[model samples]
Target: MSLFTDRQLTALKRNGFVVLSDVVDDDTIEAARDAFWDGFPTDRDDYEGLTTEPERFENAWEYIEDPDPFREINDQLFPYAEALAGEGTLERPDGRIQVTPRFPTGEQTEGDERPPLHRATGHIDGYGPHFDEHYEVGYYTVMAAVYLDRVDPRGGGFTVWPGSHWYAGDYYADHHLESLVNDATLPAYEDGEWTRGEALAHQTDPLEIHGDAGTVVFWHQNLLHCGGINTSPYTRLSAIQRFVRPDAEEIKRDAYANPWKYWEGMDGVELPSAPSER
Candidate 1:
């Protein structure tokens, strides 16, 4: 039986994302949260300290070398991920766990200045110049973020600009068709012009997702998104996982041409067509 409902599939196709509530059990959620907190530095009094050297605490592996701590959550979500990206095409979950903890900003009064909910702007993954030597024109079938704790409104939630994936797919189709599949002509990370400007121009309002401990959010690869700033006292924790099709490289051109190309069971869903020109 398919793990996702027809409604869920349609939402993913139309909105570029969908939330699966309570997908992870309480025991698994507790264990994952325990693992995350245990890996956090005991010497640090608050999450703010970890942000100073963000990379040090950004991944669960940095503190807990063992993958056993996160195995349950990954195993539980693997089937759904496989269903979303097609059977036999989904890659096994890598042990790496991306840990994002948003620390609270002190008291706020009416008229106090604050950063925007989506931060300055939303960005697509794998195309930014800041990626350094590891950069390449990359694409993935699906991305998932599992919430380990309850996230309140403005509590450093995962924010997304709805429909930005179509905009990005159009941008790539218009400007980087040949370069997308040819490694030799691929723009270096430093020279790459990302879709942030286009996303900003096309999508003005961003949605911040807040949910319970076991909530799972699945998103498209080209969706424009960012982590919101935390204003609540509680620290927000979540794990990120990416799934890729085995034939990703082989289907690169077609996938770039149509953002929904690799998504199975979305055949009848009507979505806005990519613009002929940007």
Candidate 2:
């Protein structure tokens, strides 16, 4: 049987997103969650806003970049992405699958403030030179957050504007495409800048999903989304993966720029901008 049901496929096509509720099952998700805590012990008093802590990635390897374990999961879930591509239709040259984990509250390090949900992360993903210019088609990157633990609204959940991908995509293809041709780029700004209300024009009803650990939230690369604030004390850790569907090459050529992407040179030298980033 296909991984995705007819209803699920239709939702993806019509709305450009879907939530595979409990698709991974409890036991499987628990295993991954246990492994996460075994790596990072959240016993301290202050554990909010510590995404950059060395210990976060110190114990466990970053799964988004980890393919050894990812291949197994992808084999089980890839059919859905393929189905969304269209029945019997092969994925484009750049099609691939990936995962992402959002850490809203982190261990209090030496220098940091209580992290506010960054808003601009919603716009440009995958390979955009500026914030909103570079665009890719055929699903270059899809954001999927596999909830490993129970995520409450205060647990640093994903905040998204539903049906915003089509609007954002069309807006860029309309207004920004010309700017790209003219060498126009994102205005110089500090990190974590929020393009407030820019995404609201595309979506009237923004969605913030907070559910059980087994719920998986998926969104398009161009979709306007963010990880909202964490009012709870528990750490919100998810196994985030980025996916591709064989259609990555074409997207790479037109939309994505390999500015900081990692690559390997001929003599074992690593180039950050090769075919893929490690």
Candidate 3:
């Protein structure tokens, strides 16, 4: 049986984030990690805002959806997801079981070095259009992150902006005070205002979450987080499964659609529009 518990769930609800200690095995993480790296497009232009600090990828979802490499992760996480989310959270017929394999601090080619944003969350230089990209407080309920490799501390382990959940949720729910989760409706980019200006400034450091190979981190959507940097020599890969309750509205990911390809499903889907009801 999986080791994630009710106590941890309670903590995640209260604080908006929690780390799952000793929840996965080395072999399982490695398998998923390898598959994702193999699929990253070597030739495409990773230009549009992919240079600096990183956490989650909106455009790169397909790599993790590859069946050859990601099937096992999909199989393993379903049961674990159900357990952590209580009995009926995931609706089997239409639910999405997801994961992300990230390669931070590595060469994408023969020579050029990766850019900054590799420092701890505190050190990241701010980017403009901050609020437009993120969501309001209760958009998603649970984010299950499975670390597929050993995450050394300076190697850019996952980081979250602590105590920001209260503020983030509130800003998102109201739609007037935008600070990174400034959102749009179902078709996302078809109708939205341009977010052009300086990003919000920060005074404190983001909550740093570094862990071993088998660690699993669960978070609320309102928690501000950045994907861990692979400051270590090896690649930092993680599979993330975002679990929303049965009746919830999702922040449409249309903006992240592949620049080269298009898919109908990515336009928008619903779990029942619990946008702010959480």
TM-score for each of the candidates: 0.80, 0.59, 0.57
* Clash list (residue pairs), candidate 1: none
| lDDT values, one for every candidate | 0.68, 0.47, 0.47
Q: lDDT tens string, model 3, 1-278?
A: 43445555445545556787655556766666666556665422343323342434543547654454345555555566556445675543232345443444433422234334424332111122343244232334446677766666545466775544544444444344223322321111112332323222133345657778768776645455676555444445566666555554342232121110121211222223232222
Q: How far is candidate 1 from the true structure (C-alpha RMSD, Å)?
A: 5.5
Highest TM-score against the true fold, candidate: 1
lDDT of candidate 1 over 1-278, digit per residue (tens):
76888888877887799999767788888877777677667433554554444422345556654456477777777788878776777788765667666655553322245456634366666553323455445667888898889987777788887776776676667665433321121222222354321335233578889989988999988777877766665667888877877777688667866888787746677645632233
Query: Which portions of model 3 miss their true places by more than 4 Å?
Result: 1-7, 37-69, 83-85, 93-138, 172-201, 250-278
The window of 10 residues in a row where model 2 has the poorest summed lDDT is 258-267
Off by over 4 Å in 1: 42-58, 106-115, 128-131, 177-203, 271-278
Best by lDDT: 1
Q: Write down the TM-score for model 3.
A: 0.57
What is candidate 2's local distance difference test score?
Answer: 0.47
Could you tell which candidate, 1 or 3, scores higher by lDDT? 1
